[model samples]
Target: MNNPTKEEIGRILKSSKRIAVVGLSDQPHRTSYMVSKAMQDAGYEVIPVNPTIDEALGVKAVASLKDIKEPVDIVNVFRRSEFLPEVAEEFLEIDAPVFWAQQGIYHEEAKRLIEENDKVAIMDLCIKVAHAMTKTH
Candidate 1:
């Protein structure tokens, strides 16, 4: 995937109101928790999706992306690269505008699947880091 420009990242962060954070963590030490927090702090609604916990970062947690009925503008992933295919599969079915795989979590085959749909934006980038840069500008 090509590196997203700050302008592009800013537009996505500013425009995407509701985000589904997949593989979100129950523990504070995890990158999932940190990244999710960053998104929330940046003014995005983050629906935590973790089967092990019912809640995280004070937001109601759903077991999976399919469980959330509300509109999701972006589905940010924090899972392992090998597990990305499954997450991508589930996210593609949703009506979300974007499918974002976080840093170190790209699956070429999976990315191809998500991008095949012209309606959705398949991006490989860190949501939190993107927010930081966007905010800086």
Candidate 2:
């Protein structure tokens, strides 16, 4: 689904503590960098997943989700919609609970694939915004 209900969003945010950020950039100007930084500052453990970068925001970067050894609560994707299918495949491999596409990023196929596997798929929403909203509760 393109838009998740408030309860579902809250549940995901409340349950998730460790986030894997795919396509995260080291640059401060990038949205991924800013969002992940905010998440880290919020006390969530943020793991950086980016092949091109060695690290992001002082966290070690893994090339892919498959490389992550620890349990990942949320897979926050910063990649474009066109790349989500590949990201979705990785999510399935890792059996991630939540697959979140950042603001302005959405793919029906990816969403369908994730939801079909009974995982929560959040699209076109910012993780920082969701987390901030959930914190108010």
User: What TM-score would every model get versus the actual structure?
Assistant: 0.90, 0.95
lDDT of 1 by residue, 30-118 (tens): 99998888778767888998888889889989999989989999898888889878987888778887888888777887777777775
State the weakest 10-residue window (summed lDDT) of model 2: 128-137
Clashes in model 1: which pairs?
none
Q: What's model 1's overall lDDT? A: 0.81
In order, candidate lDDTs are 0.81, 0.90
- Where is model 1 more than 4 Å wrong at Cα? 119-124
Write down the RMSD of all candidates, one decimal each: 1.9, 1.3
Alpha-carbon deviation at 42 in model 2, angstroms:
0.3
Q: Which regions of candidate 2 fall more than 4 Å away from where they truly are? A: none
Task: Name the top TM-score candidate.
Answer: 2
In model 1, which range of ten residues has the least summed lDDT? 116-125
- Any residue pairs clashing in model 2, and if so which? none
Candidate 2 vs. truth: CA RMSD?
1.3
Give the Å shift of residue 2 in candidate 1.
2.2
